[model samples]
Target: TAGDTAGDTAGDTPEDTPEDSPVEDDISSNKKGRFHSLGVGELLVVKQKLIAYEEGEIAHIENVMKGEKRSRNHRTLHRTEEFTSFELEKEEETKRDLETTTRFELQKEIDSEVQESTKKEAGLTVTGKYGPTVEFTANAGIATEKSSSKSKNLSTSYSKEVVDRSVHRIQEKIKEKRTLLTIDEVEVINEHSFGNLESVAEHTNGIYRWVNKKYEAQLFDYGTREIFEVVIPEPAAFLRYLATNHPKEGTSIPKPQKPGYMRLYPILGTNEFEEVFIPLSPGLLTKETYLKWVEKYNIQDVLPPPSSFIVTSIAFAIDPVDTGVEDEGDGSLTPNWRTVNMKNTELVVPPGYVAKIGTLSLAIFPLHRFILRGLFGEIAIGTNKHAFHQGGGIGGSETFVLSNETGLVPVAFSLTTKQFFSGTLEVQCRRTEEHMEAWQISTFNAIMNRYEVLKEEYEESISGEELFGSVDIQGKNPLENKSIILNELKRQVITQMTRQTFDEFDAMREGVLPEGFPQQDVDEAWSEGQYVRFVEQAFEWENMQYLFYPYFWGKKKDWPVNSRLEDTDPLFKSFLQAGSCRINIPVRPGFEIPINIFLSTGEFPWDSGEGGIAVENEDGEEERDIFLSIAEELKAQQGAVYFKSDGTVFHANEDLESVLTGDLIEEVNDDGDVVLNDDGEPVLINGTNFLEDDINREINIGGKIYMIIAVNEEQQKITLDENISIQESVQYGIGAKAIGVPWVVTVPTSLVMLHDGNKLPEIPEAP
Candidate 1:
């Protein structure tokens, strides 16, 4: 019934229906038949047309289809299930076809619209409100309604956006190229103006005047403007001085043709002036012009040329009061016992004064007399009548020339004064020697060779010793005692050798020679007298063996020497070998005095002082007569005592009582509690003995006296008086007084003589 009604409606509106409508009379006359007859292509065309239809028309068609379906279902309600199924299938197929066609056509329309839009954009040219234009062209399409819409949207502010983007790009570039100022630079800029106003005005006026005379072209020309933009863009100022070419002549400005040399005269008016070169250019500033300007402005007074003067010699005028002498003492003669004091002397060079010696210019500074004395050592001002055979001279009047060999000037100025003194001072120059003599070289070589042999012997025989003949040395182990003795010996040997060699060299340089040329006889009487003195010292000591072992040694080997016994090699090739060879006679504590081998017929040059040991005589009675007999023999052979110019024999008294001293292993607190180590054991001084034997012994710690009440031998610790506290590593000495013998030390007086008889105060004897 619904199909019949649809047919009726279509027939009624056939004439009224639009001509372009898809459901026209042809399709309406046989709707189902026509739809079935149509091929895929025909059906697709119909579907496309239907899709283009308005929503109202599609809805109407859908409602009509639903009504028809419902009417058919009612009609088939009583029909067989098979027939119902066939009708339903047909209906579903038709619906599916329409739906597929609709979707395909809709997608096609959308694609068409997108393609049209792309074509419009491809050939688009947009002009912005601020006059910036952007133009684009397509290869094969014309612009459509979408293109016009896009243009309308962008045109309003496109030019402004372009300007903003360009500015942003320029800012980024400037940021990359600009130099950031430091805090100080920024502060300076904020605090001060760029240039002095007066100076800038004067400079500008000068430039203006210069430009007028030099250039012929107008200042505001196109070329000039371009230059100003390129070189001086910000302030619109011209830098005409930088121009190289003359506009009218088409030629570069000529450089100055003046001499490339000049001289700077000192403002203080000295004949000595330094010559300098003028690096000339095309600019207005030349050396001559600059000098002329300086002269006109009196700039020399403000910035004067550097000046220099030579100080040929410097001397200290010592006043009598500053000589360390009191009014109660004799002024003319220096007291034999008193030392000269120079603490109050003020020695300084005036400021702004430079001392020039040849090419060397030095700024002298003030130096304290104590520092000077410590370095140069009591620089005596005059000759001594008793020390030097020369006549007595003015005490502070004579100026002794220091020999360059002494190296006093360099040592004092470079090392001592330079380190201590800050202000200006004077310097003393020394005389330099040019050459050496043949005999001096030979003698020096001999002495050096002898020294080397002695050193070798010491190393071989003494330094490598396993035992020192059961003698107790400094309460140290055999090996430790050997090391100590060896070190002390080495130190003393080096000191004495240096002094002796220097003295010998000086004597040779000054043409002062010993009376006997090279061959000299040994003074047996003087040797005997020295031995007697050593014997007396040994008698007074508790352990005389200490003195004998260190000072007295049996001859181990004979050393090679020249005919004069002065050198290892012969002074003359044809000379016969001397009957007596040279040997180093031990003077104790590592010092040795050169002597002939003929000094003693016995194995040792000196007595061991062990002859007093008890020995039975032929009568079976113990006798002390052996030492007495030796003493009598020594006295019988005595003669006038002789002194060597190079060596002086002196007795050194050392206290061996505290030889067993050691450093505290741990800090002792004020509470006087026992210090503990990391493992919780009582701390003790290593390598020390503080047991039952050392209990109750008084000890000195850090200069404070304390009595040891308890001793821990296992830990090497001593319990001291509760009142005393000692720091870690503080040295402590035991009060055990051991027998100590005084030893003879043969010190060379050459170094002392260098000070020109200025003797240092005698050191008080140790208690």
Candidate 2:
């Protein structure tokens, strides 16, 4: 009631109106003076005064009308008419103000409603599940259902039963089969070696849920390397399998045990194989040869091609010769020992010059094996000669030209491989107006925070392990040991210093720039930080094809591409932070593509433990599930399948084939004659006649008989009970053994989809 005290009707206009208001004179004066800024409290006071003035004016007019008679009535009518227009105008202004305030309040309510609706929709799209048990709703028509033309369809072409059957068939195809192949049998089966290769294929393909069902695929050896055809369900698993099972590149040589003997020793890095040649012969090395070997040992860059060999010789000529032979011969005209000069005076030979009375000169490259020709009548095989051994013996008068008999060695030989894990994922049940902005924001925050934690842990975990080999300074010949230890310590410091510089380079790559630092400055610092070209050399040596996440088909160019993970752009980081990428596949009416399937890896750098990486857990961590719990969430919001883009549908279970043992033969009593089916051909009862078909088939031929375990009529293959062993009869054991399996068995969701009760999103037709 107090709220309605302002005014009742238009005839009794509130005093707040401009007509007959107490503040009317004050307002008019302020308007004329042009100094009319009023505070909220002052304005409210003026409004009350105006209301009082209007009430007073209405009362005065009513009194005048009552006091006068007929004569005053005429004048009163004229006055009322004149004031009516003014009163109506003032009332209209009041109504306008009231309407504006109501609209403003209504707008606030609408905004809140829209926000709440958006949240609800997002939850449904991300967490909803749809299948036979759940009803398909209109909201499921997300971005995936839209098309440019009527021909583009993104709906299931077949019934859900077909997809389920397809999944079951795949499961059966990869079903485990027991095999008992003896060592001799394995050797005989050379053309189709089903031993190791088959095992590998089975392991690799078995990890995926969709394999060996409709499409026929196999793994075979073409030369030394194994080839997989449509078999890689997850690249991370494939890489790990190869690293563990595949042979290392180089061969291991037996170490010579003799006291004075020297041999080649391979130094293994995470991504490189380096052979260190022992017992370097300083005498055989010319000045040019000495510098080249020394520079490579220290991992320094090779100087540009010498204008003349003399230039290189003169550069290192300051160092004196350290190797020579001693003479210990009987009294004879010929000298028993001759010293080989490796000094500046030992004129360097021209390129490709094989002297008649001298040794052959050949260049040795990095990561390649080479043979060394010893002047002592033995060949030393190595990459390069770094040290020398001096001895006295009967020396030959003439030098013989050495032959180039060095065998080549490949890179990464004898080095361990890096390991990682991967899997696939898909999103389902999104509505048409759905936006991924929220999901993207959440993902970026999660990943960036996780990365920060890991990075901090790595930096804090550094214990400064020395780069050089450890030497005990307290052992015998302590002084010599101390000197060696000191030199090692110095090298370690230098290495750590270089690594720190590289760390800065990494910071720059990651967009962590110094204040006021220019792009040119970063480039210059990067070049200097190479420090003899050392920056993740191990990773370079490994030569991984897809070092960073190889975003699937449509997702590749979604963001700016960076050659290395360390330099990925902001948009790419956002995608990674989101922990998912969208992929598009073709769709048809009978076939449906499930949005739950995706290809991904559970790899995040810095999470990999020190020295090398291991799977996040003994049983590799489930990747997509870690980001969002689709399994449980979908259960609550049943009957919705979400999709991000358009794609082709997959038809399920189009092939079906099975085989079992033939009916057993049994004696029958029918007038002392054998019973058979129609056509007068032995009416077999619960028995099969082998003679029915032209081709003869027998079970456990030439051996004890047992029941049939399983059969696949598509391939005419059969599995007999393990108790029975058939003899080596080609015709009898036909289609008995199971083959075609690679690596270990574990199904990836990306390659072969699991169709349980999942339904496809509905597609809207074009207008």
Model 2: per-residue Cα lDDT over 611-630, one tens digit each: 12122444777222122134
Q: Give per-residue lDDT, candidate 2, residue 323.
A: 32
Model 1, 563-676: lDDT tens digits are 212211111111112221111212211111111110111112233233223435689996542333455335323311111111111111123222223333454668988788
Top-lDDT candidate index: 1
Clash list (residue pairs), candidate 1: 349-425, 364-424, 364-425, 365-423, 365-424, 365-425, 366-424
lDDT agreement with native, every candidate: 0.26, 0.24
- Highest TM-score model number: 1
Give candidate 2 regions above 4 Å deviation. Answer: 1-457, 462-561, 566-767
Which residue window of length 10 is worst by lDDT in model 1? 221-230
Score every model by TM-score: 0.13, 0.12
Q: How many residue pairs in model 2 have overlapping backbones?
A: 57
